[model samples]
Target: MLIQKSGHIIVNNSTNIYEEGSIFIYWEGFIYGFNQQSGKKTIREFFKNLQIHGFCSAISKLHGSFVLVLANEEKQEILVASDASGQMPIYKNQDMISSSLIELTERTDLNKEDLSLDKAVEFVLTGFQFGPKVLFDAIEQIPPSKIVSVKKRNFFLINRDKEDDPFLRTVKHDSISEYLNQWEILANAIRKEKVSIDLTGGTDSRILVAILNHLGCSFETAISGQPTHPDVIISSEIAKHLNSHEHFTSIHKVDEDTLISDLYEIAKNSKGINDFVGMHRLFQLHKERAKRGISLALGGGAGELYKDAKQWRCALLSCNSKNRLVDKLVNTGFVGWGMGSQTPDQLFQTEIREKSANYKKDTKKFLKDIFPEYHKCDVFRLADEIFYKYIIAAPRGFSPLMFPHYSPLLDAAFVHYGINLPKHLRFGHQFYREIIAVLDTKQEIASLPTTRLGMTLLPKRIIPEVLTSVFLNLQKRKTTISLNDPNLYSLLRKRLKRSNILKELVGIGLLNPKIAIDNIPNKNLGRLVSLWLFLRILDKRKN
Candidate 1:
């Protein structure tokens, strides 16, 4: 933890924590080049580099799922930053900095009742809160590409040196070849160590498999799901095609009682940032792998940077003004993610609804503050960037805390490349397909059907993309795992009945207590449950 006291900065040392003359460094998750090195060694080298080249210059060359904190006694300040993709999250309060949101709550006066109603509405409508602000007004996330400097109990933003900042580096829109070349550097670097790949029935993981196979990297594949599930079947096919050993962990085997308990624990740890429904399986899978002497695993997180345009298709392209664009961005994410259209109106009180009218207006200013080029970027690119940082980065970054994980695609080099690529190529996932086609030299992997895409990659057609989007939109409506299951529903209702936080929200006109927990709409149940669980945890800490 980094704290300010008596007008001085203090840093506590522990594992993965490094200290030098006047600099104390602590980091989580592994960087690409430092994967084989101990955390101490990585920090030692970072400190040395900092001494030679300074802060921003030292971090510019580093990449992967990491969050770094440097407490400089000489400078009397603490510096915090995350990886290029912001895969690891760190939060800041008034005078303290910590990676765990729940920990921050305990260390500060922030309670469940201090929650931001606008952010609450946003979280219920979209799966995650938008912008830097979290559920509480006092805690805010540090942006991915910028540094947060703490001095005399105050926070200041420090921009990275633009010339070396990968996200800011300009490349031609058609620089796909260059992009792949840069991607291969990180890919090959990661491949040097024996790592397990989280193969799934999705475009992202499949792309990883194709690239690794093309490069002749020896690695195993793992999937978590029932044998009958599409992900299991498709991932099995990909593994068989590559002649790679595959591991399957059935989600059905988890004990119901234990799963429910784990759900609350996950909610507490993630502080409601992650939807805990399917997360347990991944957590269990990694735990089992750790027991088998496997720690490092590669995930296909942040892959949407290459192909996410649904928001643009539905609303962004037609947006006429800044406010219109903000409304479309927020609404599209809310509706596109399968949170019901009625949630905003049904989940909150009348006063909140009136106040939420300014959410879009506020979000416009927020985006402009964090992303200076917000007004200049095309709608498609802007939407992708917003969704990447705000919606997906938190949960994806939090996954590593459960186990050691890295996403080769989430590397800074790829982020720069993908963000700069023309939006036309990404509109219908043309860029993703093109990369898969180029990498799947034997053509076998492309023939396998993707569980989400509902088709093989060989016959790339617009019809499949359209049909897939429609199918996903329909599936999002039924995302009520806890509510639909009799056992889980019973457990959820019992816990929610005991929730003082839920009652308080109702008292404050943020939640409608008249609506029974069991009767909450299917589309809104998972998010509501997550919020309830998070608040209940905070209430526990407060008491």
Candidate 2:
């Protein structure tokens, strides 16, 4: 890994880069090639293919969550591309490009004056910035599946001749089997590698078990959560059934001081975009996985593309106006995570409140222009994009950076097959259930209950098990550590009292510091603390 601290670059062995002659390739994340090729060779061939065929033709040949930077000294040209899944984020400006947003902004001397009021509003409301927008005005995210050509010295963007993208070629299939068949092929490629699966009680990870079992591939399973949590319990049951080696990491309770320390650590390390709270679990999980001598870990990221398309479908009905619809779409799962007790009028000073009025309008224009169509397919496409942007690409998706992580379900060609499936087949969970049934031939895996629905996928077995599970679970006390608890709120309030970042935001019209810290709703305390921590980091960088 390459660490940039106080404006100096530090190199480490974990940095995944290959250099031969004047050509250079830097990448992080897995590429599951069918023949189990080396990363160096695969990336080299990809660039060679790009030089011959074009961006679309070259990119479609590669699959996995990755960010690739290819520099050619001979041509004085560099190309940057992110995975189609958008799990890896690439931030850039005219002069600098970096995988880390904080590093980019710091190097470019971006400060409070560079902040975008609209994005600030969005961040406060939804706990994330959507599409290509980040917190800084000068820095923008390179959207997924895009190839940007830059000149060597200045890194000025160059226009490329339009090439036919074989990857985006839409093939309307007559049967669902076509999609399933492609899914298996992608799964088969990953099975050849020594794989570690993050098994959960959720349908997504469970589906992975069924598919890998069908492939007759051996894999170790791991789960992170409370010992009594459904995720840990259910994953254990499935692993026991398969007689697979399983690892469990308990999410133990922490002291208030430790919680505060972790939040600050996440804020400093998250590169200035993600909400730092609620990420400790995954951070601990990945930290442990790194020590297990695992070569590569398979995650259930982007599983929503098949298992639950309805989350996106429901956003369309959220409101009548275009901007409202877009807001609903981008902020679906994140709505209540923000300052719910305060409206824009109460939350911001006059200038920022006025600027925030155009937030919905401007955001709708920006994101809709990115995923333009208003049809069912377009809705799902935008939702999937947003998922990658806010969830996968955010600090929450830090699994890849922690350990060798990849999700074959997010394979380029297979996702193309999934999103292109008929609306009826993709919307409900039935499409995924059918795939699970086909893969779990003996019905042993599919018959197991999922953490999401707390019941089996099999119709006949669902009702009875759901009733019993609900009754039994209702009697148990919840053991998971919640950051939203009163102690956290009290600690954060004390910290905010000593910090001027909130006052600075209020002075700049981004927040209303006059609102008593006590008046802030408990649900929103984490968001406030997260924002304050990020602002503190920025303030230090400015110094």
Candidate 3:
């Protein structure tokens, strides 16, 4: 077995190995190590039994995030498997397989444009790029809980979730106990590493804090931005409460010109990635922690999968009983199809918007497939599927190069209860709060401000609201680097005109080139800037 990697593959012998044998594995996840002999004993056990049971049984029996590829040299066959709920993306075309979609596309022989114009427009409209049909049309991605086998020029899907998998056993008088137990189970999975939790006031990270606090695990926290930033202040309080010291790294401000230039470079290098803007700050935070000698960062990413992150979209797409799916999409907060339709029809310098004009039909079909049992099921479950695909697009595509990041929320055990638990109990994290109430009793789960939902002040709503308002104001003092900024917004518009994006926009005519910069505000500007940066990337990739 010969081992090869582009940066994405884990390089340490502890988790990385290439052998010249029939069974080949690219395992990227937490696995327990034995002091006795085998470095990755947990991975060893799974690999030991994988061939005997085949991919499905062995994969299902294991826990944590990973992709295992088994190749049979003698039979000229190969099996690729991943966690039931996905993490890393696996891209394959009969001749080769890799984790990076851009790398694969570059290496392929297909006569493809650097970026698929139709897909780029679709992504701009929908904030989504599907794996099977992606930014590069000819490539494909492996979704979670799946097995794809290649042999004799034939392909097979070996492990798809049965309907019963979603409705796991997760209801009882002590539902809180069940969830608490699961949390401990997940926390214990991290073994022999310098652990650090990327602390935020958000419920997701707080959940990890709860587990760590409960287990008496000694760890540090890394908080970015300044003390007045709500995340910083609230997380400082949390750190004090947990008795774990946190490193506060102030983000040095950069001017708009520098920021835009950086954004262009980032999009080009990251290959038009999602879920991050200005990764400089994120890495700055991590670098601060690294100086303190902390590695293996943990996040609450993907915890939203269990909550109704997109209840409105779920209802519209799932129920489909509504007459104006396109209208709702055009109006709502959907990063994609949402506001594009609302843009005035006269702005086209050419023909961009028209390329994805029939996107409504595609949107409805995609939504229908994802939410077939929408009416009958818990909205959280539907939201879970949505978050699984889009939101995690950040972590799935980006986490490999960031740090040894772990999301316990994606664990099968953690998600199992989240999925099967009674929908009502799951709402507002009633079950999550109950566990905190039972354990810490005064953890203030309700008072904590959430990024997804705005800050909620419980007990004394008015008083906390006043304090939160003050904190927000102080934080906003430095929030001027925004598309909403009159100056910055103008700069972005001018920059867009100089780029080839408007030319491409004219070709597709999906977006009106004539629309004034004033019409696109802060949120839209972020997307617009992202699209502008994307066009630069597209130009680079195409050439």
On TM-score, the leading prediction is 1
- Write down the worst ten-residue block by lDDT for model 2: 1-10
lDDT of 3 by residue, 21-128 (tens): 565555654432212121255556666666577556666655555555656667667666655555555666545565555556555644323456666655555455
Q: Which is superior by lDDT, 1 or 3? A: 1
lDDT, residue 437, model 3: 62
* Model 2 lDDT tens row, 1-543: 222221222222345677778776777677644333536657667767767886556665666767676667787677776666566677777666777777787778877777787777777665766667688778888766467666534444433223212134556663557765665555556554566788888777887777776667767888766666777778888886674555564564445557677776666656456666556566666666667766678877667666444445544465434445567754444322342323445666666776555554565566666554544445445565545444444433445545557776665555665556666555435666677767666777777777654667663454466466557667763445442333545766776677674676676657776787677654445565676677667778778
Off by over 4 Å in 1: 5-13, 33-45, 152-154, 163-167, 173-177, 188-194, 216-218, 253-256, 268-272, 312-327, 334-338, 349-375, 393-397, 459-509
Clash statistics: count for each candidate: 1, 2, 22
- Model 2 off-target regions past 4 Å? 1-15, 44-56, 152-167, 174-196, 216-218, 312-345, 354-362, 365-367, 375-396, 459-509, 539-543
Candidate 1 TM-score to native: 0.82
Per-model lDDT = 0.65, 0.62, 0.54
lDDT of 1: 0.65
- Candidate maximizing lDDT: 1
Kindly report which residue stretches of model 3 are placed more than 4 angstroms away from their true locations once superposed: 1-15, 18-21, 29-39, 109-114, 160-174, 250-252, 255-261, 264-272, 275-280, 287-294, 305-331, 334-350, 355-361, 370-397, 442-543
| TM-score, one value per model | 0.82, 0.79, 0.75
Better of 1 and 2 by lDDT: 1
Candidate 3 lDDT (Cα, whole model)?
Answer: 0.54
Better of 2 and 3 by TM-score: 2
Q: Give candidate 3's TM-score.
A: 0.75
Error of 1 at 412 (Å): 3.0
